[model samples]
Target chain A: MNDSAGKIKLPTTILMIVAGVFMILPFLWMISTSFQSPSEVFSKWLPSKLDWSSHERIWTGSYNFVPYYLNSVKISVISTIGAVFLSALAAYGFARIEFKGRDAMFLVYLSMMMIPPQVIFVPKFIMFNWMHIYNTHWALILPGMFSIFGVFMLRQFFMSVPKEITESAFLDGAGHFKIFFRLVLPLAKPALATFAIIDFSWHWNDYENALVFLTSPELYTIPLGLQNFILENNVDYNGMMAASSAAIIPMILIFLIGQKYIIQGISSSAVKG
Target chain B: MKRRSWIQKQGWIGYAFIMPNMLGILLFFIIPALFSFGLMFTDYQFANPNVSFTGLDNIERLFQDEQFYSAVRHTGIFLLSVPISLVIAFIVALVLNRSVYLKGLLRGMFFLPYISSGVAVAFVWMLLFQPSHGPINEVLRWIGIATPPGWFADSDTAMYAIDVVQIWFMLGYNMIIYLAALQEISAEQLEAARIDGASARTVTWKIVWPLVSPTTFLLLITGLIMTMKSFSLIQAITQGGPSGSTTILSLFVYKTAFSYYEMGYASAISWFLFAVILIITIIQWIGQKRWVHY
Candidate 1:
């Protein structure tokens, strides 16, 4: 029996290693292709000639990706901050304060999750066009600031906090805003971090909305910029791969930095629901 | 009396906090969704909004449209792939659920594809499936096959290629969700089954499978909705090409509105897709009572 169990372990170990390799292969290919010259990129094995010129061109040339990176960073940071702050406040309201239509309003917020974004794509485009925000960063940032998911997630976290703490703060003559900022915000750190990471990654990688709204090349986010890159330089596989690799760097950084919170956030939500 | 006023003030403040989002949804989401339903009945065009009202003309045309039928067929094919992918994800999740070294690293590696933009991954797959220089055909050549089908270029194979890419991208995410569900199952139940001399397969079928049905159901419903609406990957990879063989409903809506400038027709297509998904979701919700353990 022991021998049989040991035999099973050996195959499982081998299978895991194989699965790991399969999972990492694309990332490895992305990095490998990015460093290759035009001639060597499509080669059967790894690139023979390692050329880093594409990376330099992306950073320093006329159509530099620095602007795209900056646009992504600026939009993601502002929107994430905006979303966290506003959602936390709303969450506190929904979790703690009772008012008319409170349950009904919460249901409305939850129902938004089921409504496909495609349903609103055309009208929202028209709306944005009318407002003259179609081609600006405001188009991207403003809509994201009012995310329902963040509100709902944060509300769940806030509800779990002890009521005694809020009562104590109230007794100390702290107003709602003061308690929200000073007391509740600090306590909801894990939830806040979780939503921030999610929002950042989502906005950073968002392509469809960016594709539709940002018509101008100057306002192009990284995903849009990368798609434009592919359109213009479809034959230059090396350059395209390099651009793609660069675009994914920030997401990897986010995942690494907030790995714990992301896991906790997802698992907690899954179990609770 | 002072405390009552404070409570009222706090309630108002709460409303203030949620007001921005509520207003945005009312303006942007709720209003547009209702307007889209209205647009379905009209011949709306961005260039000619005044001559918009067509009175169910677009919906009538949708039934007769050959491309719409083709899109439906393609969507059906895509939906068929979802179950296969989910099963693969479930198997992988079960394998990974066991205690293993480098588990976090493995999980992250699997999840990398999910986080990256679908367009980027589609581009990589496009290169790897390129007719001449791609390694896929190279491997096929080594396996004693004289000639391999051109993956995305062949009309017969393009939808299948798109399905393969979609499955690869989604498998990791589904696996993670399943892993989470698997962990929630109590160890005592499994131990009891083990002591009763049940085989692993029997234990899984009778115990773990029933327990994880809710997660499975959730994955199924969400996966169906998502797959039905998938456009970006299809656009990036196939462009619904090789004689429009890979065009699903979402891409059809996009092409109809943007490429062909048939806003009313696209709106009709969108409504059709929405109704189909709504029916499926309702069925699943009703069926959940029977199958979903939770």
Candidate 2:
């Protein structure tokens, strides 16, 4: 970072700024278009005056996003909590306790990560339908609870912690559950936080599963609601943009709050993998 | 002996710890996976349950279908984003790794797309690339091009347009990873290269790039895998439209299963999709040894 990076050259700096602008242009357009009146949407780049009507319409009109936002919150929060806890529990067990065929089972579990979620949608549809949860949020939440990637990522983090810490706790006559709750869980907070944020985004942005499983508009997540908005008002660019903005603004806030964790988590996951 | 007893006893509790998650995996993942495999040989439509085993029939259709081939081709085009994104991200990361202004803000800007919901991304790109008067074409026209490409509206260019979105979506992740790898390179090494009178280009190509080959390899494999599996963006925008042009394999499977309720055929295509991913992964694993420095 020192001798070579004394100063950024002009061309490189210009190129970087250009790239950055290109990256953010769509987002800016989305936000700006949301403020344009419907008649002025395609005619101009920026609105003469920012309109709040489009934003207000999302809540006050027949086309409401309140239910979708609430459902997304419910599913992402519940599923993320359930996924983080379950993955950590499994990861801790695999990391700490020595059982026969444990490595073999973990190996099998690791291989399951390659099987794309798309492959099993048909059978999941069948199974969920049979269980009478097909049109329910449980269809998404139940499957979302078990993330093989979460377990795998946490297992890597857990494996790096000194075995002696958990081993000594065992010698103190504490059970695995007690140590897991009291010691291991507290120690793994950073890793757990990282995995929780990752899983939360997955459930939050998930369109395919919600599109397939949940039928009722009342059961729609943010993605489904956005789609329905698009279908009903393809011509209403301002309204559509408003809905899109509403959908992502929370995620943007979350990213701003947790960017440190998200960056660290991504790097660690890549390097360790 | 006490420790042995504890180890033995805790082994049972290990099952307890993993039990809930394992049960979940079985119920939700493993069983469905196996059921899909079985359904590949049978005519199992959702809710019309007169199931009959039709061995090899679905496979035959997969190999013969023109749309299947188009999906395979679109998937290839979609996958082009992985390397393109990696290259661009690597360049951005190299610059950002240096003395740059507002580095944190720029990094966040690039990464915003990856974290933003796919639906918003889809809609935003739609507006940006809207063929008639979208900003992109307006820029092209302003630059003296009489006819710019109809990005999402035209079938011929639709897949490439989606590739652009995918590349933008993945750029931040790749940049961060590459930045991490760049930081790992010792300052002394770069200083040594400069001491030998090497140009910055030579230093980056000969020393820095080779050193971060492992990160590139990691990004390539993971990006390829992830981009291959992702279809929600395509589903959100175009939806295999402009006459079924942007249909990647994942979206194809989604449409087949949910839209048409052809579960058996969908399962078959999905198995093929799995095989495609598996082969790509195995190829990457074997290929990594050739270039991955670490």
Candidate 3:
């Protein structure tokens, strides 16, 4: 029995290690390829000559990646702020307020989640054109501000807040706004943080909508810029890989920092839904 | 009476909170949906924004469009691949659920592909599927299978190749969801089965499997909808392929609007795809009531 148990452990351990390595391979390749020279990218093994120059080039204005990175950071920051603020307020209203058509209206918002964004891209483009917000930062920020998932998830969190706290605040002559800002908002920190991290990561990595909407080079998000870089040039595999690797750093850092909240947020929301 | 008036007054504030999102949905979602439907009836072209309406012409052209037919075939192939990937994910989740060591780390490892930028993931797979000197071909050679088919380059295998990448990218996400569901299963129930001398296979089939069926059903329906909308990886990896063999409907619509400059026809196709997804979702919803076990 002891021997069999020990044998079982050995294969499971090996299987886990194999799976771990497979999962990390692409990321490892991305980093390795980024550090390779133009000639060494396609080599079977790690690059023979590791070049640190690409990293320097990206940072020190030699490479044109600064603008792309700046654009991504700007857009992600603005969108995250917008989404968190508006969604939180809306969530509070949905959870706390007993208004007419509230359930029906909330259902309308929830149903929007099922409609694939691709279906709306063309008409959105037309609308943006008419509004003259087509290729601007407003294009990215405005639409993202009113996230349906955000409102839904936050409403779930808000509902779980004991009703007594808000009711007491109301009894103490606090207005609805005061009760929300002072009592409910402070209590919902973890949920807000979770939403912020998710929204940041999503906007940072967003490619498809950004690709269709942003036509100008200056306005291009990281993924869009990276794709354009690949398409316009001869396969600069090293440069492309370098840019891609650089792009994911912020995401990795954000994930590591807020991973606990994000995991909790996802699981709790998933179970509830 | 004053307090009641105050409550009525705050109703507008609720609207205020929801106003931005409402405006966005109105402008970006609702209006776009309407325009897309209307575009189906007009000759909306980027080249000539002033083009006149052509009722049913675009929809009529869709019937004879060979590319559309091929795209339908490719989408069917993609739908077939979803179940295979889901099964792999489900099995992986079950194994991980039983194991004691480094489960979180292992879960994160699998989920890496899902979180990574789709473009970057596609690029990595593109390199992996390179006709020569790719690790995949290298492995194939080691197995004494010389000259494996050029995966994304060969028209016949292009869609299948894209499906493989899609499966790899999606495996961790679905597995994580399944893992979460698996964790909810009662340990006491499992222990009871163990005491009764039920084998692990029987325990799993009889106890764990039934409990997880609802999750499995949900994953199936969600996976189908998501796979139908999958275009980015295909766009990046194959660009609808050597001979449009990998041209699923989403990509077909994209090419129609952007490449072929036929927005009206693309809108029609988009609506058609939407209708298909809606129908499938409804069917799955009804079917789940019968077989999902929850």
Candidate 4:
């Protein structure tokens, strides 16, 4: 119905802007309080002076926030790389290569998507603890490597590749690895990038996994670290805001950079049955 | 012999490609899910290390447990926000679908909160909903309201307050999906309807809505499943406090297992939760045929 993209509806635009402001006010309040002194958190809605002490303290606080940040980076990077690689391989196999029971196997893989992590976390926790990997980065990294969404998304992209191109590569004596790396991977860059951004942010924003798996402060991700920071500094609204703002920045930056892909990925999967 | 050779080669390569993921899922997810059922029937404790068979005992305990019922009730109450949020999101998406100025910028603004960490959003909302000094209360006071409800602190209002936060958090996601669905509606149909003297409202209600029913059904099922299993928001904001008004099933299973070390009982409760979700999903699946035009 909105085929007239060049024509701007003034009233609807005004309504959207107002709604946008309503959506953005809480975030603005967060950034505002983050720069205020602790004394001004309740008294003033906006900070008069931009004080950097809250950021300074969180950076050098007793929590040793550096390691947590590093841990998150390491965990998210490794998990994204590993998950994307494995998912691509699996997707290539499922999409391009034929095997016995391939459809059945893919159906099994797809069904795993319906099982929420809560249904299995209890036993996984016990298993990890038994394996003596509890509270370690592997607990997060290893499990994050198994992503149903990654495989599913990549498969959709892979299936779109023309069969003739892959057959031509096979005719040139290229093996599965060579074709997957050289032919399919390069062609599926958009889908790969989409899944990468989604996976990275998901791992970055993960709190429940980190909460359940990591008990040590040094092993915490930003979300878990911010949780602890909130517990101890509940009254320290300035520091809490600063920490929350910091925790949110990386994801926000990623979203801004890949806004088109993120929204596309969301809509592509969400609109489909 | 040639065909057999090709089939064998392809099979080996296919299995090789999927080996890592298959192994990982097997170890982490598949096995754990199998163990979940086993864990439900056994008295497994972390510290004690005394595993004994107790068939159906955990399920019996769940039936008798009052807090389990409370968690279920709270989950049901929280899930009511899905319909509430659907209406809000639908209306917002309709507005957004119009030819509006600053479309990209406004859409990004609405979506910013969705990408932010749940903990951060919950913490920000906690500050906003603070009883006395919060800006929301300040606005209420400015309007000659003597006192506003203590949002998370009062048991009566705690669940609804959390529902408000959830609805706000999910509104952007739902709206984006609805917007996409709306945009997918073919212009030819609308043009024909307009030529037939049908009004815009009639076109929207009769043609636009039915065309988007599939997406609506998808959103409804996913939204219900998500809100039912939500934990981090409750954990960060209220921690299921104020007399257990916000203790949904996820929070209940978490606290029972970790806080109280009742692994067996927690496993059972989680299964119960799974059953609830499974049943609801099946019901929705069957019901969609009536309303889903596709």
Top of the candidates by TM-score: 2
Which ranges of candidate 1 are over 4 A from the true structure? A1-7, A171-173, B1-10
Interface RMSD of 4: 2.0
Per-chain TM-score (chain B), model 3:
0.92
- C-alpha lDDT score of every prediction, in listed order: 0.81, 0.88, 0.79, 0.85
Report candidate 2's interface RMSD in Å.
1.7
Alpha-carbon lDDT of model 3: 0.79
Clashing pairs in 4: none
Q: How many residue pairs clash in each candidate?
A: 0, 0, 0, 0
Q: What digit string (tens of lDDT, one per residue) describes model 2 on residues B238-286? A: 9888899999899999989888988899999999989978997898879
Instruction: Quote model 1's TM-score.
Output: 0.94
Best by DockQ: 2
Error of 1 at B229 (Å): 2.8
- Cα shift from native, residue A100, model 1 (Å): 0.4
Per-candidate DockQ versus the true complex? 0.50, 0.70, 0.47, 0.66
Q: Residues A17-60, candidate 1, lDDT per residue (tens digit)? A: 78878876877787898888877866746777788988887888
Between candidates 2 and 3, the one scoring higher on DockQ is 2
**RMSD of every prediction:** 2.5, 1.8, 2.8, 2.3
Runs in model 2 deviating more than 4 A are A1-4, A9-15, B1-6
Candidate 2, residues A184-252: lDDT per residue as tens digits?
889888889888888998899999899889989999999999999889988888888899999888888
